[model samples]
Target: MKKTIQRPVVPPASVSTPVVSPIYPSVVYASDDPDGLDAQYEGGAAGYTYAREGHPNADLLARRIDALEGCSGGIVLGSGMAAVAAVLLGLCGAGDHVVGGNQLYGRSLRLMAEDLPRLGIATTLADPTDMAAVEAALRPETRLVLIEVVSNPTLRVADIEGIARLCRDRGVLLAVDNTFTTPLAVRPFALGADIVLHSVTKLLAGHSDVTLGWVAARDPDLAVRMRVFAVTTGMTPSPFDCWLAERGLATFALRFDAAQRNAAALADWLAGQAGVRRVLYPTRADHPDHNRAAALLGGQGCNMVSFEVAGGRKAANALARAADGVAFAPTLGDVGTTLSHAASSSHRALSPEARAAIGITEGFFRVSVGLEPLDALKTTFAAGLAAARDA
Candidate 1:
């Protein structure tokens, strides 16, 4: 048969395969038989017709995520917030209510509190660490309750098992954001979470390169529904991004372990520093939720630390400026150490009173500890502390 301009020849299958999975960037896939393509579209046969609906890279990554999360199925989306939106919009309808932790990622809080309400989906925010607060916020109309395994900026660990039990008793679906404490540390599904969400842009991807997210469910029906919603709403992630994320995920355990070690050392160092007022790490004995974090996270502190400088915003800025080799990037889970000013970056959406109530003062800085050597990070932080003292 003569191949035309529209029809390209495909190479024959080889006996030997490449070690790395080949990236399939083609947006449209072709089949020789029209009936075959029709069957694929009809869901009777397995094939990729379009990138948005399904693709090799995404499917491969999703399967791996499902295995890791110990779930029946999972779906990958464009970004962390995209996964959040899918869960909210897919299962929820107008007049539905949602209860979320106040300590959730600022963007998540805004999405539920401000944006969803516009669609007649009311939201209630409460302390995730307190079971009473979580239960109190739930309404009969509440469809879902969302909380983070470990909150952003503040690093307060939630009672996943307790919250999960409460949600189950109330017949509300529970979604837990496991971004901070990845599956390497804690698996939310095992603790009874109905849906597990991840900002793969963080620890799962390990490197700060890709912006991706995923939602995993043990229920096949919920997983299928989420997949449909993601496809229809165009929350599709790039194939190249998925490829890159898979590459990063390969070394996640190593990177996460090293980062955790660095964080522990950094926390200990900061506690003894003159200008450091306080340090918040899950495993730290001084932390308020230390016992809960230890029980839930298996004594693994994960790779994040939030500390307060003695002075306020001015001191924090000076510390960030003087911190040698540490970038003041707002993002986390990088190969290199970086700092984020909570009030200015992560929690900027909240009002001054709201932020203050959460203990995100101007001097508060959250560190995404990386795979840097303990000694090296200590030196960099020492410089920052000195700057903070001088300021």
Candidate 2:
């Protein structure tokens, strides 16, 4: 009975391999040869000995992400913000400067504006869609330039190719957050971006059940550096979460296509509605970055839509209440359509003036379009708009 406690059930090795990736929940691994463990620790052998240093689940997911982004290597982190932190802290040290877009996600904005400053790293916020602004923000000490493929809620697309070129000429690393568009819409690495980041908890996972993120680098050395930082800081993701995200990723393409179709329909419907003050979709002709998005994304729109209502918070609340079955959650990228109020949700950390400076307002709402019946969603939006008008 005591011996049983020291040993667990073991399955016989079979010729057949698993169709799905098996989760390796072990915290420690044993090697037949004592020198084999030393070899792994010294990077002479290709194997994992500790969960914190490396794990099979993380390695597999990282490889899959690398393949999708067409990059040499990448690393998986515990959360989306962890990926961002790893890149900044690993690549840029004290006295280094980083240039980022002004329209970044709120938490990202805080990380740059507040967190990095504490570490002696300086950050410059610029409009990523404007080449002039990005180029002007670059300083001699600038080490990294970060931008989102698309501005959150506002749906403004950035000029990745142009920025990549500018960063290259200045010997600066360009990191593009590909969460909104994903690899399906655009591959930043192919466009010459040095680094690509993703909030896998969103679109990549396709479902909101797991929290995961990754940073892929065109340069293999940078990928290794990021992974080393993640491991050192104990930012590793759980094997079970990685397994869940991989499962979600398996159906990502199909789910994304269906959600995109519904989003386009919703955008069209909102454009014709009386209460809708504005509609923001990349593919829409009236969008500020319409032509650029068309050229970059090849005429395919993403699964996100944002629109402004006529009134302020009152109108937004009424609309949310009227929309039956759709949740008004702060997060996005679920199989079911959901709504998020920009001022109260994503940009809540910002002051009213700061939020207004970036186009976020009381009446602004972002929709995470999902795999739902187009007609049914339209009906819900129509009712919501009517309710807003009455409010």
Candidate 3:
């Protein structure tokens, strides 16, 4: 396997991009070019013509993520779904097949189950942790193998490098949703992933205020196709959202560090509690993919910690309500700690059997650790646990 380091390209003098405004955290503008040129120069030819087709903010953000992912280039999308849809629709057409991870985001599962089929694309769901299962699920018509860097809700880290090798050998595209573990925690491209996607709404944005997404690839051709699909489908992020994500990127390294530390501490504490039926974190020795996660992801686990309560849905609901100061929100990755009942919030669309197969139980709750003081978060969890035990 060959690895390439991609450096950011400086836009030519004629392309005058905007300076991010200090007051508006989420908006930026491209000022008029000093040369009075309306287009970008790419070897004496125009590359970026319009905002929808291409914008300075989008390109800058893309380059930053490319650097983070160690990829050739990247495409920023309107949302995470747009990024996934662009990759799937751009890479595959009628009669093509897709092998997807069984434990995926609800919307992604819906896209695979309902939407892709409508376009004549067939899909097979497999346990990504099982290399043999993923390999066996591949077919001649399979155009892409889709997975998440870390499974949503479950927090199971996939064997990304192995899966990438499998895709390369099969002559298929490998795409990973790197939302849960942002590039700060894991670089999917370096792990052999052909394409890496992000729902900038989560850890990437750091704050819970923005909704944006991006897709990066080591292959220039793949990047071009995704850009074309994005422009044709009008799935570009607002200049405002792009600016917000960029601002978020500046603090990403710091925030993720603190959040992950808190998450690990919380996971360790939860494991010993009498009411905790299970604790799932990649760094945990008992995690199913602990070794693979350690080998591929290094020592830093993601900020998410998921666990099961002893009393099923009733206890889980009680725990959520019992937490003081922590917001019992369905979303994750904020400056303040947040919790969600996955069985009802993220996995609600799945059937009971499907949810069970994916390790999403009625007692499961996902906690996204934030930068809050560790003691405060621990106190909140302790209170929640005590309530759950009483329930």
Candidate 4:
């Protein structure tokens, strides 16, 4: 027999807890007995019963996000659209009215203006910045007031506290899409919003990989109801996705800060470019709603920059082709700088009249500034703008 070297015994205190949470991917958890099963069915303080109802990973993500939004509780969903559908279907029905922003994401506009109407829910679209228009559009049957903190692509800012007051006076629910500005920037609950929505596919997840979203309710009763709606609708996020989202959220502070800084630099530089006609950035002094944004977002907007090319669609196309270092991706919130033609991508579903009404021109494009260095970004954009001007 070969002699084996004796190994030294490890110390008892050598082990430590993992910094990351483990993914619980079971569809159904084990039950100890009939009484245990009954307790779980009746909502006891036990483990998850079904993945559709909830899982350990999903619960962990939900609690973390809820704390971020200052919400009493929240639910995680498969995607942002699913979350939107759950909220609308859960809250409104036939004969109910929804007052919404005209400059909404194309899918959001389509859902509220088209799908909701077919379901017998009336929708009135108005400019969120125009408080008077918002108030005038409200009806006695209006049960929901939906708006984005900063309008997508255009970067227009709305007054959250003022809108909340408007909804409160009418006893309507105020649900804000806080995807653009994360919790680090502003807390909707602190501003009096009743429900807060976020598409984690964008800034919250901080990576393009996760396609999850969330709905946070400031009231615990609403939270419970929303969770039921989430479960019944079968829009729950997958275990793996929830785990990835949680990991993404851990580095959100670092990613968000760097991206926002890059965006600010790009917005400032683009404002002076000869090829650009108008730049829509909330934090800039020249922005139409700069004061409004300052009051709410503290002159620090998110990572979106929108501008119109001087030469219209032709110039915009040229810029897209000339952009050497950036990519023309359909989505946002990636780690690298990317360009997207808003009128063709996010707002493509809108008609010409509707698009024109919301200032999404043929030449307009939205840039999702990423973590690239300012000097390199400037060089890339300068080339693109030059091509646009010449084209």
How many residue pairs clash in each candidate at the backbone level? Answer: 0, 0, 0, 0
State the lDDT of candidate 3 residue by residue for 216-299, as single tens digits.
Answer: 777888888988888899887776777788888889898999899999999998999888889999999999889988887788
Locate the minimum summed-lDDT window of 10 residues in model 3: 22-31
Question: How do the residues 1-391 of candidate 4 rate in per-residue lDDT, one tens digit apiece?
Answer: 9999765333366368768887777786766688998997887857677899888887889888988877656889999887787778888899999988887777998999789999999999988988888999999999898888888878888867888899999899999888888888888888888889899888777778888989987777877777788899888899999999999888888998999898987898998989789998778889999998888887678888988988878888899999899998878888888899988888888887888888988889898889988999999999999999999
lDDT of 1 at 266: 89
What TM-score should be assigned to candidate 1?
0.97
Collision pairs in model 1: none
Q: Who is ahead in lDDT, 3 or 4? A: 4
> TM-score for every candidate vs. truth?
0.97, 0.97, 0.89, 0.94
TM-score of model 4 vs. true structure: 0.94
Alpha-carbon deviation at 130 in model 4, angstroms? 1.4
Model 2, range 149-225, lDDT digits (tens) per residue?
A: 99887888998889999999999999999999989999998898898999989988878899999998878788889
Candidate achieving higher lDDT, 1 or 4: 1
**lDDT for each of the candidates?**
0.90, 0.90, 0.85, 0.86
Q: Candidate 4 regions off by >4 Å?
A: 1-16
Among all windows of ten consecutive residues in candidate 4, which has the lowest summed lDDT? 6-15
Candidate 3 residue 54 C-alpha distance from true site, Å: 2.3
Model 1, residue 140: C-alpha shift (Å): 0.8
